[model samples]
Target: MRLTQHDATAPTGMRNNYVVMRPQNLSVGVLPVHDDGSVTLVGQQRFGLMNYSWEMPEGGAPYDEDPIDGVKRELAEEAGLAASHWREALKIELSNSITDQRAMAWVAWGLSAMPIAPDPTEIIRVTRVPFGDLMREIARGSVRDMFTVATTLRAYHMAHQGELPPCLAKAMLASVR
Candidate 1:
């Protein structure tokens, strides 16, 4: 990441110099859900936050590459799982005022185990929590990663609003109650 200074006019017609952070690549987040309404999560110490965080598997993708490809790799590498189904959950700009980091998130199912291959810098712990339990933790502030939080909430919305498959949505909603 790098910061670049730019001269810009504010909404109030004031001119000022602003330093903006530029991220190198687009990022992707995946919420891997099982047939039983459990979701896979990866836990690791975040360097920027200096705290241990549990988040849905997420990673960066180059601008020239399909974000789905990056999501597949992240799921396999961080959670040791692969999905036969995929659905786009959200596309968002994170902290848009400070950084130009955009992310795409997906809800993946039809999960099967794969070989885990984490990056050399990552010491990740993998876990599967029920959908409802995950939501509870998020509300309680234990799971604080924005990507994960957003994706999970989107998935819940999908389940309720008929965006997700009926059977899968039923299972997911059942877990919540």
Candidate 2:
């Protein structure tokens, strides 16, 4: 990460120095949904927030690497799951006012077991929660990770918009009701 300062002119024609943070590498997040409308979540102590967070499997990807490959790797490493189908859900600028850190998220289904290979720096715990329950937790502020929140909301939107298979959408939407 690098910090730099630049001049900014306000609407009132006042000038000031704007300090900005530039972060290296792009980030990827994946929401792995099972056929039963359950989604896998990973829990770990986040250094940035200094709190335990339950979030989608997420990690940084080199700018030159395909984000999907990073997403696939994170899903396997953090959740021990693989998906047969994938859909890009969101591209977000995290803390845009402060940093140039960007993230891409995906919703993946058709899950099967894989070998877990967590990062040496992380101790991850995984759980499968029903989609509606996950939504409720987000609403209750138990899950505050932006990547997970945005992707899960997008999946819900996709289900409602008929972007997903009928059976899968039905199963997913049914959980919310």
Native-to-model Cα distance after best TM-score fit, residue 65 in candidate 1, in Å? 1.1
Question: Taking the tens digit of each residue's C-alpha lDDT, what string does model 1 give over 1-177?
Answer: 899999999999999999899888898989999999889999999999799999999999988888899889999999999999999999999999888999999999999999999999999999998999999999999999989999999999999999999989988888786
The model with the greatest lDDT is: 1
Candidate 2 regions with alpha-carbon error over 4 angstroms: none
Give the range where candidate 2 is weakest over 10 consecutive residues by summed lDDT: 165-174
Q: Cα RMSD (Å) per model?
A: 0.8, 1.2
TM-score of each model, in listed order: 0.97, 0.95
